[model samples]
Target chain A: MDGEQQYIKNVDADAELVDRARAGDLAAFGELVRRYESRVYRTARHILGNDEDAEDVLQDAMLKAFQHLDSFQGQSKFYTWLVRIAVNESLMKLRKRKTSRTVSLDENIETDEEPIVREIAVWDDNPEQRYSQGEIREILDTAVASLKPIFRTVFILRDVEELSTEETAEALGLSVAAVKSRLLRARLQLREKLTRAFKRKGDQILGYV
Target chain B: MVTCKDFLRELGDYLDESVDPQVREELSKHINECPNCWVVLNTTQKTIQVYKGMDPEPLPEGVHDRLIGALEKKIKSQA
Candidate 1:
């Protein structure tokens, strides 16, 4: 295989391992888990917004994938199939833990958007630049997080994961047109947030810190 | 033959290699003539680049063991 085709094969190779695992091959199953554990957990974490919930979602999704592996025909990549499972698991977890979420759609409260999406660490900087950067990251994160779930998912799958629209559409069961539309909205939203974030951070650093 | 909006609309498709050759050729010609279109192209390119640069968060600690354990338990029960 050429480099690109070889890379694709590396991903497709999971289908073979999955097939073996379905035949009761424990080692094959383990290999599959090792290959995707981090990515699955990370996707869950981002969608669910907490490590505890992310872990639960990952466990649920992995178990489900193992159980349903017999039905996988390799039409979609293993990772894509796995991600769909994880997304469902995370959303289900969110529904289950609905009461615990700090965010409520009904409340028009003026919550700070930045800190909600990203954790802020103490800055070692002379206190000014550090605060500024953290503030920017916060706004960027919040702006990203505020996107409607569908739009946000498209952004995550396409931009962050570098999946093409067709792949994203296949994974999410969306049309290619839907994926493109949502992706454009997501990007425009992020750009607006980033612009506002940097400007505000710049002003704050010069004035307050 | 390509305008700024047309270029932006086709840009993603072009990057994904889903655009037809005619549109691609038109976009190339437009890029050569239009500074505004060039800026949009540059910004969109950088946006994708920055996105790719962000490090994907790793799996939560012990995710492998947890998944494997869960899978084993579920599969065994089914069997």
Candidate 2:
């Protein structure tokens, strides 16, 4: 494996780092961060929806992880444990912040606010087409940004980070039913956004009401 | 009448394959017979497929490194 892949594999294993960190090896703890930093940061970013807050949450989460490292017996994977800490810390920070409240669409709505829709189109893999990737990613970023903090956290953990429902429930301190409920709602909201965008773009020329 | 709206409301669970077998069997039967419900099911299914296709946004450059650095610093200061 290349150095990058090897590093990723090491992180995924969570073996060497857990053992070393338990023994108070600072470098091993650093490796744990290397392994899960992006996930933690992204989860924070999605929940908090601001770079500065996400950064603060990331720092706090790191500190908490370090302080509580001893309690992390290998029952669950290291990332799951770490993520639970990070997500809870991030959500706590988010709750403390004064953010606007958004509505959850339990059923279809009649509003014109086009939910930010991300189109995941694959063209021939060309480095020059990086612009397209940025556009689609921005759409997803916007869609995520539009969600309520709790739903955003659930979606980011489940869909983006690929955490299972049970793990996500543990991380967010939500029941499995709550996780499933929020996930279904989040998926519906995201779908509405994309559907509106596609329909608008496709039927724009017709100009029908 | 089992309206399309009702079908759409349960569409999330149906798509997840989370509905009970009895409900699933009934819904399948309804969708098979009812064009409107079927349309709703098709649209909802296609919409979910599209959403799931979205790529993971790569983390901001230096984010991982910065996080690791911050973590290491915290661990060191405590030691």
lDDT of each: 0.66, 0.66
Candidate whose DockQ is highest: 1
Task: Output the number of the TM-score-best candidate.
Answer: 1
Tell me the deviation in Å of residue A45 in model 1.
Answer: 2.2
| Predicted complex 2: DockQ | 0.23
- The two-chain DockQ for each candidate, comma-separated, is 0.27, 0.23
**Residue A30: error of model 2 in Å?**
2.6
Per residue, candidate 2 scores C-alpha lDDT tens digits across A112-200 of 23222133221222322434666656666787789876667778787777777888887767778677767766776775554444443
For model 1, which pairs clash?
A114-A138
